[model samples]
Target: MTDTTVRSTGRLRGVLDRIAEARRGDSSESLAAVFLLIATLLALLWANSPWGWTYEAFWHTHISFTVGGTGIDLDLQHWVNDGLMALFFFVIGLEVKRELAIGELRDRSQAMVPLTAAIAGLALPAVLFLLLNPSGPEASAWGVVISTDTAFLLGALAVIGPGKAERLRIFLLTLAVADDVGALAVIALVYTDELHWIPLVVAILGLAAVWQLRRLRVWRGGGYLVVSLITWVALHESGVHATLAGVLIALLLPVYPPKRREVEWAAELTKRFRQSPNPEYARTARLGLDRAVSVNERLMRLYQPYTAFIIVPLFALANAGVALTGETLLAAATSPLTWGIVLGLVVGKFLGITGSTALLRRKLPPGLTMSQVAGGAALSGIGFTISLFIVDLALTDDEALADQARIGVLVASVLAALLGAVVFKVAPAPEGPSMELLRPVDPRRDHVRGPVDAPLTIVEYADFECPFCGKATGSMRQVREHFGDRLRYVFRHFPLDEYHPDARQAAEFAEAAAEQGRFWEAHDHLFAHADALDRDGLDAHAAALGLDVERLEEDLRDGDTANRVADDDIDARTSDLPGTPTFFLGVTGQTPTRLEGPHDAATLIAMLERMATAASPEAPRS
Candidate 1:
């Protein structure tokens, strides 16, 4: 390719890679929630438009199928709720299984605080709802008040920036997951119709068939889908909510990683693929890769995006279109059912969650403070998706009650989000620095970019091969240009060996370059040619930077050079560093403000300005 073409292609590829990285993280969740919100607004507008009757007509239109002298029928709304939502529940089940197996719920002690708080949060809402509607049909709809929408809550937290309340976000997520479990239990036990014994028995047998399939190591996607469909249909016929079948099947799936023997066999197969370039070897290698990961993880990767982006939004579009006439508004404003839902979610969640945390303060996790608990509790009241869901299940026969419940949810969610945002804004920064930049810069051992006595210092723990670190290098250069003599920049090594195999050796080489006073030159060269960072590449760069090639090679072999890199690694671990390109800025004796992620130049400069302003003696303390 020509030079211009190659450069353009490289830039395009860089953009695509960044986009892919974003989709893999919390950004995907945020995007899905945004789409869901948009669908909800469209539904509301459509229902209130001049063509309002079309909204009901379209969603209520029946769709039916028949086979072998039997038929099944459902309206468009019911199809979305019963069929598409089953997939959504399946994804939830996968998340729950993953958490219990390896994520937050893996530790009993760590999970206790949120688990207890979730129970309290659920119970208080039901009590409030019951008090408002004591022996009436409305009393049965208490489940609508108990669920906290995970997507909307997480999306709002992301917008709020988890930097100030990282622990608070964790607490909220755990509480929401626990709340989901409780809500699922309520659906299965409280909302079911009359039981059909034969269909229930058939459903149990289908679950056993799923268990047997896993035992036989049946990994084909189609086989599992067919069996799960059978289980779902049987559960539906049994008069239990078919969505619960998703949770049951997910719990039964194998979550264990490949056994040691299987791993060894995969390694052997990979070696054979390398030796012989045959199709069979390649196919076996692919199978080996698949076998190395658990079924739960594989299925989550396959299904999470579909459920989030498509199924959930369709559910919202079908369910969120409640017409708001003048009479209906007046009734909702005065109705006990509406007031019950609104107050139960908004007031009860905050009181219950915060009260429970305070009551158990002595036994709970040390990371959470009272202010954080309060803020998280406020955010927990932003219940949208699942609250609307339970409304459909609980008040299915009473459209007036369902509309009242929907109105209550909409108003409550907005108020809760606003209240939580205000609480977070006014809350004090948590006690002590969460991250400690403890390693002092030694003039003799460290390579410095600016004056040693500069007012502000930025210490970066980075890996040479990390793309985010490469992006951060440009931002650091901009920071130096903006601050000049006021900033002192220090670099530290933190090579992640699992992801970047050559990074540790590269760090040692950079340290060796520091011995010859060309550390900065080597640093720039390594990042500029990040794709080519082997031993020969390092030597070539050192030569180009005017270092004595012989001395450079000798210094690389010296044990002290490797020891310097190891020291930085130890410091990073001690600080509980999250990832590469993590920045810390402050003066001596005071704790530094820790900034995570690959921030842009403007953001870094803004943070420095804030730090400078805060450090000024004239500045007033809040």
Candidate 2:
């Protein structure tokens, strides 16, 4: 390659890497929200521009295909709605599956609060919409008002500064997922047309084939995709919405990790690959790694970004281009359809979610206050993407009604976001210390990075395999640089074993490296190569750090190193650590303030400076 071409390729690779990294963090939701908003604005501008006729003409253009004497025909807009949106729904199905299997929905006791709130949120909005437009074609559009858009809601929460009220964000996330389930149910049950038996039977048979494939442990993506597309086509021919096919396939896919024996076999193969260094062993090791995770998680990691950034944005551009002329705006404002949707989303969601939570307060989780619930409820009103989706389905034959519903959704979402931001801004921070450092720091036993006598001590509970944890490593290093000797940094293990399969062994490897006085080296190396951390990769890291590979392997084989990592995990659980890269900062005896998520370097430094000031002997205790 030429030098100039090489530089251009390098720059392109750099950009792609940055995009991938960003997609792995909390910022991915924000980026998705930005793209959605930009697409919406572009659609509006295009519709209102002098060339607006082209906008309508282009989307109305028909595309048709035929295969084996069967033909399919659809306009550009219908293709976006029925096809690209299926991928969007597929991602939602993956999220719902993950939550049910391991995330917030796993613990029914903890999940009840949001689950109940979501139920109320879904019902009351439809009730309000129905009351306004009872027994009309527009009444069926009630589903548009019932869901909470996860991307827009989360992006709004980020703007409102969740801070100590981080639990509020969690509540909203769970509620939104449940809301999505409800919306999908509505689409399947109410929006579907009369059934066609033959194709429906064929679809059922295809699903049965999928279940058989699962039973046979078929993990190949291509095989599943082909079967799923057949099922989708059958469903479409059966008069059911084709998009539900994605959800059906997703729910049936296995989410459980490989069995213990299989994981052990993979580990053994990885070890052999390390010893032999041949292509055959290498391929076997790679397959072993792939088998260790469920197909659900693998598919999610592969397709989530495509759904979030590409598919949804395309959906918005296709659907949100309603002309905003004075007569159209006036008609929308005066129509009962528009008012019903606005009131249903903005008023009904807030009242239903907050009131239901209040009524069930005695039975729900205790950490959430009424004010926090109110803030969350207000934010839940930002129903944009799925609402527009339902508008397309519910008012398919009436262009005027569809346009009005779209206008109402756009307007209500903006108002709800602003209102929620104000509420969160004015609400009181949670009572008690902002965060408590439940585990005391031990200089002798813990991996320490700075002076022991530093005024501010930061203890972080993190997992090596977590992408957010890897990002926080840079922030922690910046904190050390900004504070120099005045900050003592301690690391602890809190691997999310269900999500990151290789994390536990990686933690053990780090502990083993600590035995040879290279804990930080191993720590940096593990996070820098998070995607490649297997048994052999751990050994390679140890060898590169000048540690005795044999001794490291011996330490890993021993139970003591694993026990040490387990102790950290126990401490984290006891402290109610919510997620990875949780930090606690304070002096030795004082209560340390806690923070979570992948915070930026400046935020970490500012927080530490405040803690340092408060920890000084000259400062008075509260």
The candidate scoring highest on TM-score is: 2
Question: Any runs in candidate 2 off by more than 4 Å, and if so which?
Answer: 1-25, 258-260, 267-282, 362-367, 430-432, 435-622
lDDT of 1 by residue, 1-622 (tens): 2333334333433433343343234567678779888989988999899998999999999998788887668899988888888888887787787667655676667689899999999999889988998878788888888989888887877786336444566678778879999999999999996899998999999999999999998765577889999999899889998889988888878765334344445556666777687999999866775575567766776787888788888888998898989977998999899888888898889899999999888765434578778877887897788888889898989999889989988888888888788877888864554665656666665677899888788888999999999988999999899989888898989998778867887888888888887789889988987876654466567777888877766675434576578667766754668889788888645666678644788887887788777678674322
- List TM-scores for all candidates, in order: 0.69, 0.69
Query: Candidate 2, which ten residues in sequence have the lowest lDDT sum?
Result: 1-10
- Candidate 1 lDDT trough over 10 residues, lowest sum: 1-10
| Candidate 1, lDDT over the whole model | 0.79
Candidate whose lDDT is highest = 2
Q: What is the C-alpha RMSD of each candidate to the true structure, in Å?
A: 11.9, 11.0
lDDT at 531 for candidate 1? 76
**Cα shift from native, residue 22, model 1 (Å):** 9.9
Q: Give model 1's TM-score versus the native structure.
A: 0.69
lDDT of 2: 0.81
Candidate 1: stretches off by over 4 Å: 1-25, 258-283, 363-367, 430-622
